[model samples]
Structures are given as C-alpha cells and as structure tokens.
Target: MRRLRRLLLLLTCLAIAVPPVAVYSDAVAQERVQRRTVLDLLFGGFGFGRRAQQQPNYQQRQQQHRPQTRSEKPKTKKKVPPAIAVPEPVVVAKLPDARKVLVVGDFIASGIGDGLTEAFTEMPGVAIEARTNGSSGLVRQDYYNWQTELPALIDEIKPAVVVLSLGANDRQMMTIGGSKEKFRSEAWSKEYEQRVAALSSFVLEKKVPLMWVGMPAFQTTSMTADMSAFNTIYRGTVEKTGGTFVDIWDGFVDESGKFVVTGSDINGQQVRLRGSDGVSMTKAGKRKMAFYVEKEIRRILGDAMTIGQPQGGEAVSNLVVTTPTDAADIVRTQPISLTDPALDGGTVLLGGSALDKGSGRSPRDKMIQKGEFAAAPEGRVDDFRLDKRPQPIDPQKATN
Candidate 1:
C-alpha cells in the first residue's frame, strides 16, 4: 500500500511538470511569431525601415491631384481692361547685335516665354526680347488700348525681326463706337479692315522685318475659324509690308484645321506640341517653337557669319547631398534630362541597361523610361513626365 501511494504521488508530479513545459513552449512560439511579423513590416517593401511608411500617403496624394483636370478656379472678375493692344516684345536692354531678336504676341506667345528666352542660349551671340501682355492684338478686340502700348514696344525694342504673334483673343464681341453695336455687321468688318491696314502701315514704318505667326487651331472649331479670319488680316498685312509671314498655324494645326499635337519635328523625331492645359505649349511645343525661331535666326545669320563647322555640346550640373543623421544613409540618386522624357506609367528604366519592353533607358540618371505601360510595349509613350517637376516623372536620365 505504501509503494502504491508513492508511485501515485510521483505520477501526479510528472503530469504537473509536463503541463508547465507545454505552456512555456507555447509562449515561446507566440513570441517568435510576433517578432517575425514586426521584422517583416520593418524590412519588407510593404512597410519597412524609414520612408516606407509614408509611401502610401504620398501615393494617395498623387492619385488625388493627378491630371484629372479638376476645375478649381479661383474667383475672378470679368471686367476687361482698356489698355489692351499688341505691345512690342521686351528685350534684355543690351545684348549684342547678333543676339538682338524680337518675340511678339499675346498670352500664347508668353507661355513658357521665360523658357523660350532661355532657349536663345543655344545661339552664341543671340538674345531674345518680347513685349506681349494680356489681351493684346493687331486688330479686332472685345475692347483694349493698343494706342498706348504698341508704339512704346516698337520704339524701345527696335528689333531686327519683329515676331508678331497675336489674334487668339481678338475673336470676341464688344462695343463698336462708330457703329454703336458689336463688330459683326459690314460696317464693323470695314472698320476692322481699316484698323488692320493702319497696324500694317505702322509696322512697315518701323522698318523691322516682321514674322507674322498665325494662330494654332483651338479645340473649338468656331475659335479656329475666328483665328483664320484674324490670320487673314495678318497675312495681308505681312504681304503688303514686305515682311515674312510664317504660317505656324499649320505647324500646330491639323489637316482638319484642328489643333494638332503630333508630328515628326524638324529634328526627325515624332513629337506632340500642346500642353494638357488645353491652350498651352508642352515642352515639345516650346522646343518646336524655338526651332522655328532658330530656323529664322539661322537664315538671318547666314547673311552675316561664315559657317566653319557644326558643333554639339551638352551642359551638366551635379548635386552632392549629405545629412547629419542616420548611420548608413541610403543614397538613391535619379538623373534628369532637360530635353528628354521618362516614365510610361508605373514601370521604370534608369539606364539603357534597365529598359524592358515598355521603357527606354536614359543616360541622365533620370528615368528615361519607367511606369505602367498597357498601350505601347515599344511604341511612342504618353505618360512620361518629370520625376519632381510635375509628373512624378522619371526624366530622361540615368538611374544608377
């Protein structure tokens, strides 16, 4: 009986010990699992060490503010200003004669106007001056004051070639003082013809050769027709005054008389010329415009400078960045190209070595190609933009 009691007690102790061990084993397993999960969140692309946490919110902001064209216009009044007329282009006051050139027109001329001016740096001794303000025209306006501004522009710039680029805003209804009605009837048209005649004579008197740039077609067919009428005035003025009238309307307009954004440029590459904003120039647009201007200037230069040889060069700038914190800072550098493209959608190609079916590589350390491309596996891309400028765009640059 004593042995039986002792054995029973020993069995009870063993059972108790086994239960505690099982419990401890389960606790350890749970701890290990929790640690692994935290590590995954820290190191994985799903969340990870530092910047990974903020990526989701950044992506959300991009999706929200993307080029969906939400019309959140600031409140503005509709009172048309009276001091409206095509003024002479503003110049940099003192550039060499080789650099002295004129730029003219309305808001469209002024779009990337600063950038357009910068493009003149390609020319060794060339300079660009422009004098277009808001709502200026050669003839026919809803209302404005050309009398006050145009003469000053002419006298000050005294440009070698006066680039006249207005007429988009001339298509509007306004008070006709003599006829006492809007400029639609025969009388208004007659008065309009007279005003055009006066403007032409004035430009001729200035003795500056003029380049009459016709308006590019707009989304609205009616506006296109209106621009055509205004261009007729421009053409007539140029013809009568012995000025060269380059029909850029065709440069930017389509066979349907619509605004064309696609074509092979003078550089032997297909390109688009319109911005997404409906009435502005894209980078290609700006470059193409500069190209046309360059053609004109080159022709003029041929009259004076001797051509020895053609040369090419590229400009480069680098930024060295360092922060005071973090033991091992990851350095992710993206190159940027001022003149090329990057990103098709969500994919990325940093260098020529990384381009897949949807992308082409760049040498700029900017992404020449990257993004989600469902359309062209190898065709012309549409969604390329700047990595930082606007499109989250990878630019035409190197990745490594």
Candidate 2:
C-alpha cells in the first residue's frame, strides 16, 4: 500500500512537472499549448508528456478557420470604337436676284421645306422660303386663313414658284355661310374644292407657277384612305386651276400598296422613312418627299436652277443681243425640209435609180413596193423549201 501511494505521488509530481515544462516550451516557441489534467496524465491520455502538439501555425489556423469564398476572374473593360464623322452639305451663297421658292402649309409642308432646303442647298441661283403654320388647314379659317395670308406672302416674297402642301389637318368640321358642315359631306366637299381653287387661283393671278404636292399615305388605314381622297380632290381642283399636282403615293407604300414605315430612299437604299407616331416624317422621309417636288420645280424653273456661276462676273439674263456691223455682212442659210435627200448626203431616194430589164430587182424591193414577203433565210424555221439536205460543215469554220 505504501508503494502504491508513492507511485501515485510520483505520477502527480510528474504531471505537475510536465505542465510547467510544456508552458516553458510553449513560451520559448511562442505557440499556444493545451493544459493537461492530473487524471489524464495518470491514465496516459494522448499527448500527456510530449510537448502539447505544437498548436498549428497562427496563419495556417486562421486560413483553415476562415470562411470559403467563390473564386472570381478579374473583370476586364471592353474597347469601344470611335464614331465616324459625317460631312455636312456645303451651301453656296445665293445671288441678290436668286429666284425664291415659297413653301406654305402645315407640319408636312414644313418637312418639305426642310427637304427642299437640303435639295437646293448647293444651288446658288435658287432659294427656298418656307412660311408654314403647323396646325393650320383650309377648314380652320378662324384659326388661320390661308386665303387672307397667301396674297400678302405672294406680294412679299415674289416667289418664282409657289409650293403648297396642306390638308393634313383639314379632316375636321368646316363652317360655310355661318353653318358648320361635317367633313367630307357634299357641302363640305364643295366648300373645300372652292377653297382649293381660290387659293390656287390667287397664286395663279400673281403669275407664280403653283405646285400642289399631294398628300402621301399615312400609317393609319383611315388616315391613308382620307389622304387618298384628299389627293383626288387636290388633283382635280389643282388641275382645273392650271396648277401642277405632284403625286407621291408610290414612294411611301410597299409593293402591295400598303403603307410602309421603311421604304426606298432618294438613293434607292432601304431606310426608315416615317416616324413612330405615323403622322410625322423622319429625315429620310422628308428628303424622299421632297424628291417629287424637286422634279417639278426643276422642270418649271429650267435654266434658272443652274448650280454654280462664274465667280467674279455680273449676273446676266439668258437672252443675248448682238449688233451686226452691216446687214449685207450677215450670212444666212435657207431652211431645208427634214425629208430632203440631201440630209442623208444622197441626191436620190432609196430605189430611185432605174433598173435595166436584164437586171431584175431584189426580193426586198418587190416586198416593199407590192407588199410581198421576202424569202426566209435558209436553215431558218420559216424556210419551207422542199430540199432538206444537210450541208457539210467547213473544217476551217468549225475549227474557228
């Protein structure tokens, strides 16, 4: 029993000594050491005497205990290309006597003006003056009367050509003889026709060539149908009043005659022509619409629409007057008939020469004079000769 007690005391002493030594070793190594109990030491628990398994490295312990995060690749920025610059059209300076084209009407007319300006931008002899009220129409004289305003504009601008593009906003009620007439009714149509004629006649009286640009098809079916009817009325009235009607229906429609948002441009390239609202025009649409007007204007203006002129010379009219030194010095040639044989450098007409009885006339001459058909060429399908023998091929011709 004494030996057992001594053994117990020795174990207790060993346990106490082992802890202090472990603490000293931990301190020397600068590491955390797990303290062991005396019972564990006596029972020979794991790592009882060996330096408490050197606590894992501080950095390694931190890394092991830290939460895991998703690995993400570094983000890189994409390179964007620089925008290309578009060149603006160069407009030449207009002469003091440059002819003016007065464009008047509603919003569509304003778009036409914009397009015409671009169209004639380079012409020094032509100028465009657009006088438009966006919401004005023939029906709303109370709002704005074109008849009253047109005379003043003509006198003020003295345009060489008067271009009218109206009726987009004229689909509402109209007042006639102090009575409101519903749109498109018989009475309304008469009044509208009269108004168109009156406006056109006023321009005609002023001696300005009137160009009534007809309405184009709209996006809405009803609006397109209304425009078609309006165009018809415009064509009839304007033509009756000696004004030129420009039909632009085909430009804004597809092959099936339906309204299109995109269509061929002035350059024949496919492009967006109309706006989202379906009433207004995009830039391309404006340009295309102007194309129809431009043709008529150019045709009417003729030589007045020449682009560039001699830089430092005085502007002169096309007519040239020259004084001859003497009347006798003037040389003149007699006018000859278009059918004169001299025109072809021949004194005799075709088959004019008399043929000898021995020299018979050709089949062509007989066919021309007697309405007889010339013989068909040999080997031709029309050649109905009884002989059907195959001709031998020429070796040289075949080789060639």
Candidate 3:
C-alpha cells in the first residue's frame, strides 16, 4: 500500500506540478517514513556478512557525501570538473597495511557516533575513531573556534579519512569582546568567514582525505540560504585543497526544491530528519547519512578493505555498529540517502532521506530575528543585517 502511494505521488508530481522546480504543498510536510540501511552497522568485529533476517520493527531502505583550498596548497581549479577553486596540499602514499578512519564535527556528528562505529567496525584493515563536540562549527563570526580543535586532532590521530559535519551552532549574531560587533555585517561576516576558510586551508595542508558533509535539504529558505552560502565556501575550499567534494544537495530534495521528509524514512513515521530544527539530524537522519559515507569509502578502497587478501574482496565490512548499546536493538535499517537536488544551485538541508523534504512552517521557519546583529566574530553587524531575508520560495529551477 505504501509503495503504491509513493508511486501515485510520483505520478502526481509529474502531472500536476506547475513546474518541476516550483512545487509547494502543505501535504509535503506530512508523510510516512521507512527504516533503512545500505550496509551493516557493527561496532567492532572480525567478520563481515548481512544477517538476512527480518526484525520485529520493519522499515524501508535509503542514504547520502564534500568540498574546497590554499598552497602551502596546490592550485585546484583547472577550468573544468577536475579544476578546483582553492589550493590544497599534496596527497601522500598511505600505509598499505590498512588505514585509520577519523571523524570530526559538532553535535550532529556526535549524535550519530554509534551508527558510524557499527558501520566500519568489522572491516579487516579498517579502524574507526570518532571525535565530535556539540557546540562547534567552522570557526568564524557566529560560533566557537572549531578550527583550533581540528588541527590538534588531526595531528594526534593522523587519520587517513576524516568525516566532518558541523557549523549549525555557529550561526548567530556576533558581538566583540569589549565592543558590539556582529556577523551580519559584511566586514564582520567576511572576517569570521576568513577564519573558517583558514581552518579549511589548514586541513587541506595535511592532504588527508576529508569528507565535509553539507547541511541537509531544508524546509525553510532563510536557514537554507545560510547553509547554502556555507556550502559554497566549503566546496570551494575543500575541492581546491584536493579533497573530495560530495554535492549532497541533489539526492534528498524534491522536484519542487523543498525537503521531502515524510514519505522518505523507512518506517513511514513522520520525519524528524533532513534538518533537525533546520540545523541538526535526528537518529534516523544521522545513520542514513553515515551509509553514504560508507559507500564512498568502499568505492575508494575496495581491494585494500581486507588486510593481505589480494583478491578476496568479500572480506569487506560495509556496515559496522553505529549504535553502541543497541547492538541487539533489532530495528530496521536503510542507506544514507537524500535527493540532494540543486534547485537553481541553492543550498540543501542535510539528513532527510531521499523521500522526505522536511519542509513546513515550524518554529524554525519564522527566522528568529529578536537578537541583535553585529561586526564582531558574531553575526553582530546590525546596520545591514535585516531582521529576515526571503521566505519560502517557488522552485523555479527544481529538477527531478
């Protein structure tokens, strides 16, 4: 019945849509969800195989991956797909024995720790480590000096793969130490952004493989725009720095350019993902996102997954235990997927499965503007910062 409904909806999407890019409906906010996972979720183990058994709580399957740099960084843009916009460090030979996977980010990344652990635990030659702080972002005007932490962590772990997600808490009005400064002001915002860019540059210097997750497809345009701007910078810096830039905006978005969270998740439950409060990922959201990461990792190192097993690629451990205590919590699982649609190259809210857009007139959609804007490392510049930007938009450039 649910599958039939999805089919009907897709057909409706094709028939009555004013334009593929300009879809808007109150019903879009309400739909069923499914539980899903592309691979296994093991915390730590030696073997790899799917149980191929159904659990009590059944759900459907789904999932979603980065950006930008400087010399000290190499010139990345080559006037084409291979070209980049920033400079990056050189890639060095990694240990053929096996590689260490290190993850870094703010709260959203932290929340999904268990799922990530499970996803990578059983791989023969792979060891996974997760480091995350709740209140961190790419240090700039609005939030904490998240940049300072990354360098130190990188030095210590020396990880071959870095999965990073943050920058939500950092969105705020900036105020200077002694004076009133803000992030909304161009001067302050650019300054704060420069610091953020600097940190991205530093990451590029290490030449370590980094995956910078973009915010998921958002329900509101205001928050969505902010994230989009951030993504521009992230991609520019990460790609320029010789790191992989996964354009996640397309996978989770609807033909109308909004979040489609409802009919998306596995269990057909109302979605709590894509954009948690328009800024975070729910339990379902994070695990789904992790699957995308797993897919990319396996593709990059297929043969090396098992140590010394030249051709027996079957030893590959795709899913590990992402939830620690829930080892026996036989819930449904699915891939980390999102439509990631780029509606006229706009920003995307992360975490929603491919079916859910997670858009509506919730508290977040109002755009809390009671706070002051300034020129300090906060979004404190009030002169130019309006109380709000645009509202929900018509998707003039949405694609299926």
Candidate 2 per-residue lDDT, tens place, 1-400, comes to: 9999999999999898874433356455554455678877788665554444444455578988887766544557888888888887776899888899999999999999999999888778889999999999999999999999989999999999999999999999999999998989999999999999999998998889999999988988998999999999999999998999999999999999899999899999999999999888999999998999988777767677654666565433332233476999786554445677457555533445643455377877878888888778888999897976767999999999
lDDT at position 62, candidate 1: 95
Top candidate (lDDT): 2
| Candidate 1 lDDT tens digits, 1-400 | 9999999999999898885434467535433322236657665643343244456866888998887545765658898879868876543333345545667668767652444565554444555777776577644444555555666887887766666667667664544674454544676566666666666567778876666666767766777777787778668866876776667666677676567667656576888767665567767776666656555655554432222213443321111122446756655446544445353232333543555463353433333344433432323365454342433546655463
Give the TM-score comparing model 2 with the true structure, all chains together.
0.61
Model 3: lDDT of residue 192: 62
Candidate 3 ranges with C-alpha deviation above 4 Å: 1-98, 111-114, 139-144, 175-181, 263-279, 299-302, 308-400
Candidate 1 lDDT at 57 equals 60
TM-score leader: 2
TM-score, candidate number 3: 0.47
Candidate ranking under TM-score, highest first, comes to: 2, 1, 3
Q: What is the lDDT of residue 246 in candidate 2?
A: 92
Q: List model 3 lDDT by residue over 202-235, tens digit each.
A: 7778987677776566667777677677777777
